[model samples]
Target: MHALSELRQARRFVIKVGSALLVQQGKPRVEWLASLAAEIADLRKASEVIVVSSGAIALGAAKLGLAKGGRGSLADAQAAASVGQVELARLWSDALGHHGITAAQMLVTIGDLEERRRYLNASATLARLLEAGAVPVVNENDSVATEEIRFGDNDRLAARVAQAAGAEAVLLLSDVDGLYDRDPREAGATLIERVEGVTPEVMAMASGASASGLGSGGMLAKLQAARIAERAGIALAIVNGTYVSPIARALDGPVGTLFVPQGDASARKAWLGGRLAPAGVLTVDAGCAVALEKGASLLAAGITEIEGDFARGDLVAIHGPKGERLGQGLVEYTAAECRSIRGLKQDRQADRLGYAPRAAVVHRDHMVRT
Candidate 1:
């Protein structure tokens, strides 16, 4: 099969366009946006597609005529984002309209994706857009987002979108072509083609931000995005956005850095790991902890203590004896019930709680082993 076919066969995908790709000469690149819309139009015929876009701040800055080399404070940045987001959506709508595709703009904050209910709601909205044959163009809600809670970069936002949308792959398009052994401009630096896994050595090769005065994210951010995709069992590709058909070319495997998925974790597990909020903690013994790490379920006997009050089905963090977080899982019983049955066997749960819900406090299927 053709390399591009791999991506073509994907049921869903999230494509991220960097600030550099969206802006040129301190303004939105109309032609680039049109080209990307055209590409998405083609891909939509074969698969569902969602776009995680950047450049709101850059566009806003240009529109507001912010002085160059001025003090770039958070207030300035936020002001710019407010101005630019309108233009960003307007450009997207006009560009995609050329191909008879409607574009729907969706602005999100980190809090939305980190919370389970909000995450599910966001996912549902995007899925509905896909079902309606419309492209959902997502961006960070920069106008009100504080630095502490900001996604920091669209690369990470794209990964979260991929996870939330149950996408099979995430394509991160940026100024650079792909990862290299070192800075490509430096003497003897070579491009690293395919990475089966992201090792410390590979991460060490990453450099800081680019010389181009476009965006904050660099090679390291893309690497971090890959790690997020990896944990979600979603493939990731980093390619140059300068090319006219960059997305098409990367899907065809012309040349790019591909980050392989770690394992086949279900969408629920991915959601649990990538999107859920932990309401409490479950401390376990060493043997039980190892079992949980090895992908085993959490039983009543293994649970030493229930640290917080939470309802049944609420997300909880599983901790080891030393208080290290082993992983997060949906608890089978209420915190009160769990506490009452601590150190009891599976059969004893019924007697303690008046009735047993399941054989384990957290079934393996409901748990995401870290």
Candidate 2:
């Protein structure tokens, strides 16, 4: 099992800030937010950081004088989220601005991450923001996301974002120091330093609700998030965020429970190969088949046929002329666009399409050989 020190070696990270740590009695914790911003500023000197924040509903509920923690009707919760999103974004912008850091807000729903095209778009957007030296503040679209189709807690949402961003690790800073063998409120409960995997026994240790009653996630939700990280070969840790500079403190010592990564496949490959329902199929000629064998990208000149109505970034099965399945990959062009440039060389593709298409219909980096 790895220790908290592993965080020091990671180049990119996704940090989840729960409602309990950011909101108190229905108001934002300005001082704590400032402390967190300072730590993030320091961390950004050597690494890229992404924050998954959850406090809009809590903050909004307080302002609207509705049931706290979104315990009331779904409509009420949505209304509170509408009011809180503005405040949440402003708070993060103000806090990060103090340290000369630009804060970018990204709101998404579960469908955004689950759908291939939207997933790629979201990932690319985040990459662009990070490349420009800005920290992305991601949150679930609670205001419009229905309760039946929403991620009620931010923990699982953070894990999905980590996967999308190809982050090295995830840090879930919450109210508790770490996972305990039992409810920490119990006298005999003890903290577990390292978790090799999220086993049934380990999962049993989690509780349902947070102590602060301001957030929907608890130890159980965190464990679920850890499972996602473990499958994606990303390290994850749970630590207390109540203290000053908690992220810095955790990285300097063994202050949290580290969940070791167990995935044997690359995160991208795992995601690409795991799609059970491919959106379309592309049948390439023998020339393309030969090039693919040499690990070359799938060029437009090699494509013989395109089937199914699919958009760019959608998963498409690649087939050789002999009707044998070559593999599956994300396409770079829509079906209509592919038809306009199929079997055309580089210059011909540009002439026919009236624009230069990407170098490859399916880039080698986005392909998974079966």
* TM-score for each candidate, following the candidate numbering: 0.77, 0.73
- C-alpha local distance difference test of each model: 0.82, 0.87
Give every collision pair in model 1: none
Model 1, runs deviating above 4 Å:
1-5, 67-71, 208-211, 275-370
Best by lDDT: 2
lDDT of 2: 0.87
Q: Tens digits of per-residue lDDT for model 1 on 249-292? A: 77665677878788767666777776434778999999899888
Per-residue lDDT tens digits for candidate 2, residues 1-370, read 3789878788998999998899888878899999999988988888999999999998888888896466688888888888898999999999999999999999998778767678889999999999999999999998888866777789988888988898988999989999999999899989998899888789899998877787888999899888777877889999989888998777786688899987746756756653435778899999899889889999989999889999998889999999887878899999998888899888788877778768899999998764
| Candidate 2 displacement at residue 275 in angstroms | 10
Off by over 4 Å in 2: 268-370
lDDT of 1 at 273: 71
